[model samples]
Every structure is written in C-alpha cells, then in structure tokens.
Target: MPTTHLTPTTVITGFLGSGKTTLLNALLRHPALEDTAVLVNEFGDVGIDHLLVDELDDEAIVLLNAGCLCCTIRNDLVGALSDLRTRRARGEIPPFRRVVIETTGLADPAPILHTLLSHEALTDDFRVDGIVTTVDGLHGERQLDQNIESVKQAAVADRIVLTKTDLAGDTTTLRERLRAINTTASVLEAVSGDIEPAKLLDTGLFNLHDKPPEVTEWLRAVDQDGWSPDNGHHHRHDDGIASFYLEASQPLAIHRFVTWIERLLETEGERVLRLKGVLDVEGSDAPIVVHGVQHVFHPLTQLSRWPDESRRSQIVLIGRELDEHAVRSSFDAAVVG
Candidate 1:
C-alpha cells in the first residue's frame, strides 16, 4: 500500500484516574497547541468539566455533554465534528489542523476511533494519526493485569504515555511490564501532565521507514497466523471478555457481508466489545475498514491505500464470552454461501 499523508487526529484514552483530563488541560496550555481543537467527553449526569477547561481561543473547545462516546449519544460526536468543520469554514473557530478527542475515563476508544475513521461526513476532513493511551504509572501494571479495557487501550495504541511517574514507586518496572504487553508502542513519561505535545501526535497506523527493527517485527506479528483459536492466548477477564480475529483471502460478497455483520449484532450485541478490520469486498477499489463496539457501528470506511501489501481480509475482534471458533466458522459459512 502506498503511503497517503493526511492531517492527523489524535485520541487520548485510558481508564478512570488515568489523568486524561489533566493531560488535556496541560496540552491546552502549550504554545504549540495554540491552533488545536479539543473535543472532550465527560460521562456523568451533569457535565461540569467543560467549565474547568480554559478555552484560549473562541470555539476551540467542544464538549459532548453525553455520558459516553460509545453510546447512542455518539450522534452528538458526529454533530460536533460537523460543527467544527462549519466553524472552520466560517472563520468562527480557530483554523486548526489537529483534533484531539478526550474520552471519558471509563470509555473505550475503539468506538470513538470508528466514528472518526468511518463517518462519511468526517472522514474526508480528518484522519486518525494515532491513538495515545495514558497509563497511570503507579497503578498501570496492576490495571493491565485486572482491567480488560485498559489492556485493549494499550494493545492498540501507537504511543503510550506513562503519567504520574513522580508518584509511581518504580517507573522502570512498570515501563518494562507495559513493553511486555505492547512492545511496539513508543513509551514516554509525563510528570503532572506535562509532556511535549509533538510526541503524542502524528504516530500513524504503520511506521515502515523509520521504525525500530523490533517495531517492524511486531507489525509482522499482526498477520492472521499470529492469532489462532488453538492458541491459548485469548484475553480472559470475565466470561464477558474475549479477543479474536477473522480473516478471508477472497473478496466478500457485499450483500452477504452486510447480512452476516447485522446478524452478529442481533445475536450477540452486548457481548461485542470491539471489532475492527480491513475487508476486501467485490466492487470496491480499496479495502473497507469497519469498527464497532457493543451495538454501535460507525459507517464502513475505505482507505485510499491498503496499510500493507497483504490484501487479504483481516479483522480483530474483542468480545465477552464469544466463541472464537464459532464466530470464525459463521463468517466463513456466510462467505461460502
């Protein structure tokens, strides 16, 4: 796949008490971030955090009063992005090139990314540069061991920011443990939410040229063979937590593909934690990438170029109590039929 450079939008996601708000507040104060737009989602009955943030420029901050970005209120997110584009066109908001979405502490970022990447109205205007996950340095090790969402956030991020290092008894040990889970992500330290803004932005999906050898090796590991149902490497949180993959070499029959996906949602909606993948469909010039969490699915998106030369369809699934073999078999049956 040839490289296509687009203006990057970064997402900051982590568990509650991960200092996401603190990091945003600090970033907003940076001189380099003068022209950036910040989208904040606060999950609560009454939204008060919007008032806490000091918006330097007029209309620079848009707060989604809705509780979570992954819920039905996600339409509000689409509206907010649309509004941002309108304001930019009318010169109402600052002419910003970067967008930063801060998900609620308990929020899962996969759905939000799906929205940003798959929204028809928004994709033409913005691209996901990368995901920056903030892990509490003090509690990160324990959190990764216990919290399934936290682990997913770490696994999918292009960059991981370790916050509260000043309080963490052993930053070195925590960092090592994070590396074990996700060795490809660049790990940076933050003290009191203070870190260089440039480091957190623009780390795109695939870093082919300048990445370390280890990172390249890790990227290769993303192939279908890397994740097999026979392997005991499945994610285990509750019976409600699972992670698996789906792969297809032949292009999917578009109509059948739609039916298959819809049926999955109808049958196992609640248990579907996160689903993302690149699909090769007949009649499409490029691969269609889809993302969803729980019942909400952003519109399917087509990348200008494949992330790599591997044109085969490959998807990663995160669900709870969902049988990996059954899901894969069902998808295969649909394609064959």
Candidate 2:
C-alpha cells in the first residue's frame, strides 16, 4: 500500500538506570543503522552522551539538554527535528531513513508520544514505528511493585527488553512479573542492549512477521463473541494491569471506528498503556495498523501486504484498570447499521 512508504521511527525509553544509553551506543555502531539519526535527552544542562558516541561518516547524532522532551522541553524537540530536516535538505546529516529518540531515565514517555502523535508538522514528517522499553531485570520487579511511572512505562512498550540480565538474580521471576503486567508485549533479553539492532526496530503494530508464533496465535485467537468481562482467561494484577483481546469479524466503518477510538481516549486515556491492532476498513482493501500510548494515537499506516491470509481485524490491549466489557460494548454500539 502507499502508506507503507512512510519511514518508521523508533522511540527507546526506560526508567532511570535501565541501560537505554547503553543500547543507543551499541545501536549506533550497527552496520544496518548507518542511515539513522540519534536524538538523545539529557536530564541536566551538561550533555555528554552525544560526545560519547564514536561518530561514523554515515550516522548523525543530536542531544537535547536538561528538560524532559515531553513538556517543558518540547519546543527544543520541535526545533531539533526542524534542524534535522534542514540539514538533510542541505546534505549535512547523512540521508537517514530512521530516527531514534532516547528519552531521559526519569522521563514519562507519554508526553514525548504526544508530541509525535499530536504535532501537526511532525506527524506529516515522521511515523512512530514502535516503542522499545528497556527494563533493568534486577530492579524491574521492585520498580513495578512500588513505582507508578515504572508501571506505565512497561504497559506502553511494544517490546519489553530485559537489560542487565546477567546481574538479575532470578530472571524467570522477573519475566513472569513483566508478563503479568503486559502479556502482549514481546519480551527480549539483552546483556547490555547488545542484541541484533534489526530485531529492535520496525516491528509496527500488527506486524505479525516480527512476532513469535505464539504471539501471532494469541492475537488471532480472539473470541467471535467479542471481549466480555466474564472471560475466565483474561488476566489482571493488583497494580491495575490487565490484558484482553478485541476483534471484529467484519470490516469497520472508518468514521465509526474513529469515533469509538475517541471514546476510548475520553474514558480511560491515562490508564491505557498500549494498544495495537490491524483493522480492515469497510472500503479499503489494504489493512491499517493502529498503535497508541495512553490517549495519543499514531497515524494508521496501511500495510503493503497483508502479513498473512487472515484479514480479520484484531487488537491486543494492555492497560491499568481498563474495562474490557465497556470497551467492547462501546465499539459494538458504534458499529454502523
């Protein structure tokens, strides 16, 4: 589809001391990442992270200082992005196809997501490919148990990477805890964010090809009756984490679908951690994949090829206190007659 032409930008985030910077440094050296630009956010006035990268002739790196890029520092983000475009136009920075944003350790990624989703000019120029969150395997369990922001970070991740796995005392327990919080997120291991860079990027929402067979099967396993509160298989934890599937057998009316999504944002915006799905619109032959963080929704990009023969609309939602029954009811009610 024409929409597939849009280049994907990956946002890498994690709580403080989660090894995000280590991952970015490692990724910068990857041969495949030659045509990539790295955007870094430093929590203080001194920006030394940018100086740490060993610059190659093919890559470009820029750092945003001090303020978090989401709110107080958003204007800086806009200016930097604009500067990147200008440099690309003037042939200064390498002709990069991908952009990576690395937020500070304490940053709440939702605001950064908002800038990418709600900014008019930025949306036209870039598409959110996916969000990759690094969790400190040793401390992640404790963080999730005690920290609300940490819970939010894990909930919104497209890929949850367990960093510093070598130091984690009980890897299995940590993995189990993460799964309980967000069952649909792909969990990966990274000694020092040293895994293959290709695996970390470009896994757009509903890109079944990138998912393990079990995940693909999980998404396709949605019940025909639609999501309901009584489903015994659905899981939840005390920290407001819940997982459920939503499916539509028939192609959805575009306007109705949009309206239902808006209603979702209005009702449980803050609690919604992450949502991803493939929708077969009523009139469009190609499938559109939707991705969102909290209330911020990325532009739906149509796929060039159906990942497989299955064309049914399916979505996986992971959130805090998300009411599956209410969400399903609203969607069903919004269906065009």
Clashes of each: 2, 1
Q: Per-residue CA lDDT of candidate 1, range 167-250, in tens?
A: 667788878877876777889888767988888865665333433354334334433223321332222225555456577888
Q: Tell me the lDDT of model 2 at 324.
A: 80
Question: lDDT of each prediction vs. the true structure?
Answer: 0.68, 0.68
In the range 293-325, model 2's lDDT, one tens digit per residue, is 566565676655454477777766667688889
Q: Cα deviation in Å at residue 285, candidate 1? A: 60
Off by over 4 Å in 1: 1-6, 205-337
lDDT value, residue 84 of candidate 1: 88
Per-model TM against the reference: 0.59, 0.59
Q: Candidate 1 has what TM-score?
A: 0.59
